[model samples]
Target chain A: MEKILLKNLGRPGFHTIDSCLVNGGYNGLTEAFKHAPESIIQMVKDSGLRGRGGAGFPTGLKWSFIPKDPTIQKYLCCNADEGEPGTFKDRGIMENDPHLLIEGMIIASYAIGASVSYIYIRGEFVFGTRRLEAAIKEAYEKGFLGKNILGSGFSHDMYIHRGFGAYICGEETALLESIEGYRGQPRKKPPFPALSGLYGKPTVINNVETLACVPAIIEKGPKWFSSIGPEKSPGPKIFCVSGHVKKPGLYELPLGTTMRDLIFDHCGGMLNEGRGLKAVIPGGVSAPMLNAHELDTPLDFDSLAAKGSMLGSGAVVVMDESTCMVKTALIINRFFSHESCGKCTPCRDGTPWLTNILKRIEYGNGRPGDVELLESLCTNIFGRTFCPLGDGAVMALRGALKNFRDEFQHHIDHKRCMVS
Target chain B: MFSDKAKEEIQQVLKKYPNRRSGVMDVLRIAQRERGGHLVKEDMEEIARILGMQTVEVNASAAFYTMYNVEKPVGKYHIQVCRNISCLLLGAENLIKHMERELNIRVGETTPDKKFTLSTVECLGSCGTAPMMQINDDYYENLTAEKIDKILKDLK
Candidate 1:
């Protein structure tokens, strides 16, 4: 598919304001001012846009949830804390065409009646932060931001807020807590961010990729967007394909693209000869791994969910036949264990237990009932935790066991890795 | 004492947020960078006084984040290797092991002279270029054993 979101990427001087303007940049902000904020929301709704961050909630529905009251302070937080293993698309947008995100934020904050917007970015994105800061300054100087923006009587202030390396902050509620100068922990979800968020005010939080898509959806009519992909899942999507692939990088495919095409056609296939594809983590570590045969499945939110997986952050990590499943499970669990935040007991306690058990199995210390113990632990951790972190950690455990039981069994029975 | 430049930067960060506390992470980073690459207890006190926060809160905030160094001063070269899923799948383990052997130090140990400190971090978001490591602010990716040799030799 022709790239709309990443078209400005790698273009010389794209990060600068003049370069972006010359390439028909802030025109989306201009296009947005032509309609009422309600009409803008309605257009996004009509576009059938879904949140690109792990959750596939409808973008328009999420924005519409903001309180209609004009008295409360409303906010738009851009979740750029892209530390999810195997996900790297957001880094590209922030690094190359930062003004695109800045422009998207202006249009989105205006639609949601927010006077302020914050880009909650990952601390590891040092280069991204510098470029985005420059973009914000440029946007401010051009009158695209600040009071009476573009003379539309809609004022929006944009700022870059850096996160100090925590994965849980990627979750919206935890992100709000981090923004409020507290530890990054998930809050009880009775009052969602749309109602009371970011210092107890109405807030609309969105992923960097999701917000970056808004300007284009407004520029092109909604009818043009919904016609691009599957009716239920429309619009272009950026898949961050990594791991053992011939050409592992970001592939911008229209929605409903098959996982097989992404790996074989788009990414150029497995790493090398005699290395057949083993298992693939369809999304970030949070999503279950798909087997070789399951590669034919369509890569969309509904399609993957039907197959007991999710199009989470569209992070497709491919592994070759030589890769060790047991070791992969161990490493993924360790990531969750290190970043659990310890807010709630289920996640705080369960994550380490999962990692310890996986470590023992990988190192050939599996006991007789270890498999059953893993199953039981995953069952307890899957849905009982406060946030999805608990469930996400177990996704690797569950998927590895379900698809590659033989490899795990080999380690348990022979007390050695089988892949080599 | 915070440098004049760091204090000015802290003030600018404070002005960016409606709430003063929201700039805690940035202030901590600046303070850590300015004060010989780590936040001492005294530095935390200065941070608390500047942000109008409790010293304990500032210390707690520093401890909560993985990037901030409060316990000990980091070496001039802090080698952070990414052992996350993507890099792990692509020889990141062997690369990490290679570095361990080459440097004659373990993952969590700093050299006696404090020139280099080695640690394994979660992910640096450079999955496309796997087997990557971050030394200070720069990322060295698509690394080979040969690449490691050259990088270490140059740094040495």
Candidate 2:
């Protein structure tokens, strides 16, 4: 499949507006301006593009939810807070070929009738931030932004809002709060961001990769895009491969590519020839992991869902047999414990407790019934938190227990890691 | 008190948003940078005055985010190694140990000369190049012991 998202990547000066225009960037916004905004939304809906930011929400459907009244101020936020443990694809887009994202954002803002947009980038991504800031400046200077963009009488202002090292800000609502100069904590849903967002006005939030697809969808028509991948989830997906893979990097393939091909063929198998695959976290740490037996699963929204995992952010973390499952669980839980926004009691309190128990087990001080105790704790915390952070921690621990229950048992009973 | 340059920068950041409160993070970031990598109580108070926000609100926003060092100052080089699962699987812990041994300071501790502070952070989105660390604002990826030694030695 042809690479739509990363097509301009690796070209010298691809991040510059001059190079981007030479490579046919901003053509989507020009094409979008020729049609009614509603038609562009419809085109996106027909293209079957889903939000690449974990939840897999449809992009056009999300845009359509905005109140059609043009008088009300609407905002579009590009979520660049790419802090998920094993996910790094968005960073690649923002740091390299930033004009692609800028063009996509312009097209999206135009489609949604948003005159203002913000790229809420993570503060740690200083380099990506500089690239995006420079690109936005270039776009404004080139008459692609500001008043009467491309003589279409549609004006949009884009700004870069740097997130101050809070992972919770990746959540759309929390991102809105952060932009409002408050603590980055999630707000209650039912009035989603599409309705009451970014200062209680209608807003649309999209991941960096999801918005980057808009230019291609408009320039090449919807059918050409929807026909590339599987019928349900059609598009070029960037899968970030890391961990014990021999060649770890970003691989852009059609959605629904099988995990076996991604790990063995694309990533060059395990870290070395002697090492065997133990398990893989098919998404970020938030998604349920898949054991080596489940390597045949196709990596997509629906397929991974059917297998009780998720294609979250398309981050595939490969682990070899030398990895101890118990230690893995402990490390993952510790991350959740540290990152859990203290808004939810169950998440803020329960994550540390989960980390504590996992640490005890990994350190060989675990007693009998600790494994069952963990199972009970997961049951209590799974559906009881304010947001998905608690559920993610529980799901990750449950996935580990489901596949490596005996390993946990051995750690408690034998006082050492089973593999190591 | 903020420097004239920082105040000018804060005003520039304020112009980007409709609400004055929306500029709090940028103001705090500027204050932290001006104060040499950490925010002081007086700095937060001054920011609240300038932005028409409560000092408690400024402090809360500063404390909520990890990048702002509200409590203690850091060294010239803040060496934060990624310890998330992907990096962990690639011997990030060994890298942390190596740094500790070389610096003669444990994790979260500044060196005796206050030149280097070693800390373990969660993923910085460089997972494809495992065992990575960020020094100040730069990323050093695909690390080895020799690479780390050179990186540390070359830093002024």
Using DockQ as the measure, which candidate wins? Answer: 2
Query: Where does candidate 2 stray beyond 4 Å?
Result: none
Candidate 2 residue-wise lDDT, A41-152, digit = tens: 9999999999999999989999999889989999999999998899999999988879889889999988889999999999999999999889988998999889999999
Report the C-alpha lDDT of model 1 over A166-189, residue by residue, as the tens digit.
Answer: 999999999988887878888999
Return the lDDT, model 2, position A34: 97
| Candidates' C-alpha lDDT | 0.89, 0.91
DockQ scores for all predicted structures:
0.82, 0.93
Taking all chains together, each candidate's TM-score versus the true structure is 0.98, 0.99
TM-score of chain B of 2: 0.97
Among these predictions, the greatest lDDT belongs to: 2
Candidate 1 — which residues are off by over 4 angstroms?
none
When candidate 2 is compared with the true two-chain complex, its DockQ is 0.93
iRMSD of all candidate structures: 0.8, 0.6
